[model samples]
Target: MGSATSSRSRASWLALLSAFTAGVGLGFLAHEYREVIVANPGIIGLTLLVVFAAGYLIRLAVRALRRAGSRVDTILAEELEKKPSPRPR
Candidate 1:
């Protein structure tokens, strides 16, 4: 049990470190290409559009899933209520 917990903790730390390193590398690249990025207006607009579209799609999916979950909960509750209680011996 102790070993398993330690392994999970180590994995989590490694994953976080990897993500941080990647972010720093990306930051450097973005800084290096700042001039080129600024020169392309279309790229910025397209990026923003894609981001907004993705967010909208995710929102719709979450809403649909929540609705379905609520319906299931309601059905389950109704079925449980309809069940007759056992009589005392």
Candidate 2:
């Protein structure tokens, strides 16, 4: 149980770190492209909008996958619980 908890905590931390890293990378990329973005304000604005929308979609996908995994886990646990335990000799 303790190991499971620790592993979960580690996974949570790793996820957080990955999110932060991705955000930072995106920010850096945006900064690097600021000049080009500024030159074509209309296109830049559209691109930014697309990026935001893509991020939202990605977030939704991640959430859906997590929900699906959790549901599967719950169903498996329920099925396992319905099984009788083996008697000790």
Q: Judging by lDDT against the true structure, name the best candidate.
A: 2
Residues 1-89, candidate 1: write the lDDT tens digits.
89979998998999899979988997898899999888998988898799889979998998999799999999999999998888765
lDDT of 2 by residue, 5-81 (tens): 99989999999999899989989987999887668899877887999999899989999998999999999999999
Residue ranges of candidate 2 with Cα displaced over 4 Å:
1-35
For all candidates in order, the CA lDDT equals 0.91, 0.92
For model 2, the run of ten residues with the poorest summed lDDT: 36-45
lDDT of candidate 1 at residue 44, scale 0 to 100: 80
- Best prediction by TM-score: 2
Q: How do all models score by TM-score? A: 0.60, 0.63
lDDT, model 1: 0.91
Colliding pairs, model 2 = none
